[model samples]
Target: MADVKKVATRQSYGEALVELGAEHDDFVVLDADLAAATQTGKFKAAYPDRFFDAGIAESNMVGIAAGIATTGRVAFASTFAMFAAGRAFEQVRNSIGYPHLNVKIGATHAGISVGEDGATHQCNEDIALMRTIPGMTVIVPCDDVEAKAAVRAAYEMEGPVYMRFGRLAVPVVNDADSFEFEIGKGILMREGADVTIVACGLMVQASLEAAEALAAKGISAEVIDMHTIKPLDEDIILESAKKTGRVLTVEEHSVIGGLGDAVCAVLAEKNPVPVKKLGVNDVFGESGPAVDLLHKYGLDAEGVERAVEELLA
Candidate 1:
């Protein structure tokens, strides 16, 4: 077996978009004046004419992308997660979600991974915002391979989609040949009966590490990469909860209205368990290193292990 290389989800989006643009002329790339920073510049370099820079006007950019989608184009609008979901939220809701446009919103720099850029740039609520919109497909890929697959999947699926990515380089859990990607399906990384750790985005890496740490201490922790937030994998979650009798959700977003809440809503309605959530506990982030911010907000692997211990206790 060959050693698998780990790639960041942001890089995956950049590489995948270029390939998609090359294959389909209908696939257009739009950026809100931050193409270079968001990594969409890769696509711009390949397909210059098909790329549109909206010059800081995220709202108008989303509207333009939605309009383009209506004209039989798969518009992929790229910007910071905060601006994409927070600034142009209304435009996305009305123009994209309302009309059910085939628009792919690739929002990068999500979570505190923006590091020294501070809270204003970090989007901890992007998932919650996108999930609330009607007819919106929300996804957070666990690694670079998954992110590329997600981009391809988003282009094929019809409807408004928001794909969130972070700024940091995370460990690649899944490789291109490891498994196939499916929308609304949960990937079970490790199986156990003591507890289930359902995580997304950067937290998926943390959760997997925590699961390994827990196993060293005689606790069997099942880890699930619940990448898709909207149209969540309910069956997998319910089954995990029923088998483990305990569940802990970890995310880079806030504990409220994010992946944790989404999992809780499903488990509560079906099979309720001792569910604990590890994330930003209702607070904004500060200017610092990405790993420091994660620790400060109690979202690191140690934090996840602590949450799992508490749930088991």
Candidate 2:
């Protein structure tokens, strides 16, 4: 196997948009002035006529996307996670979610991995916000490969979708040929019986590393990449929980309303088990290097391993 390249999921989203633009003429893109930063500039370059820069008005940008969707077009609105999910939330809820339009919100720079941008830029509640919207689909891709696949999936699916990516680069975890990207399905990256680690976005990589470390310590840890947040793959989660008897959910976002809560909600109803969540503990992030912040927040491989060890202990 070739060494996986490290690239930001946002970069993959941009490349995927260009490819999607070439494939579907009805696929239009809109960015709220942060084109280069959000990676929507690539789409603008590829399909200038189909792309629209909606200035800094994220609310208006989402409204414009909703309007465009009415014309039978799949509009992908791109912007920073903070503005897209927080600032323009009302517009997204009323204009887009209310109508159940075919609008895909490409929210990049999500979670603490945004780095150095401080708490304002780091969106820890995007998943929670999007999940609240009725009939809305939410996805947080693990790496560049999964991000591209998710972009394509969002375009193909109907109704409203919120796809989140981070500014920091993560290693590609999936192979193009073998990996099958499904909208609401969870991918079992590594199988084990002692415990299962369910993770999304950047945390999936850390979970995988933790699984390997655990295995060396004679602890068989299963790893599941739960890319999709809403309409979560309940079957896989329950199956894993039943098999392992213990579960751990990890994410780059807050442990409050992210993958952890979602997993617990299912397990609590279906099959009760001990579930530990590894993520930001309802605290705001500060300016620091991306990797440093991840480590400090206990979201890295070592952090995950320690969490798992303590959970099992």
Task: List lDDT for all candidates, in order.
Answer: 0.90, 0.93
Clashing pairs in 1: none
* Per-residue accuracy of model 2 over 105-220 as CA lDDT, tens digit each: 99999999899999999999999889999999999999888999999999998899999999998988888787789999999999999999999998898998988889999999
Q: Name the lDDT value of residue 220 in candidate 1.
A: 98
Off by over 4 Å in 1: 1-6
lDDT per residue as tens, model 1, 1-313: 0154556678788889998887898889999888877889999999999999999899999999988998998999999999999999999999999989999999999998889999899888889999999989999998888898999999999888999987888777776686798899999989999999999987888888888899999999999999899889999999989999999999999888999999999989999888898888889988999888888888888999999998888
- lDDT of the structure predicted as candidate 1: 0.90
Best by TM-score: 2
* Clash count, predicted structure 1: 0
Of candidate 1, the 10-residue stretch with the lowest lDDT total is 1-10
TM-score against native, each model? 0.97, 0.98
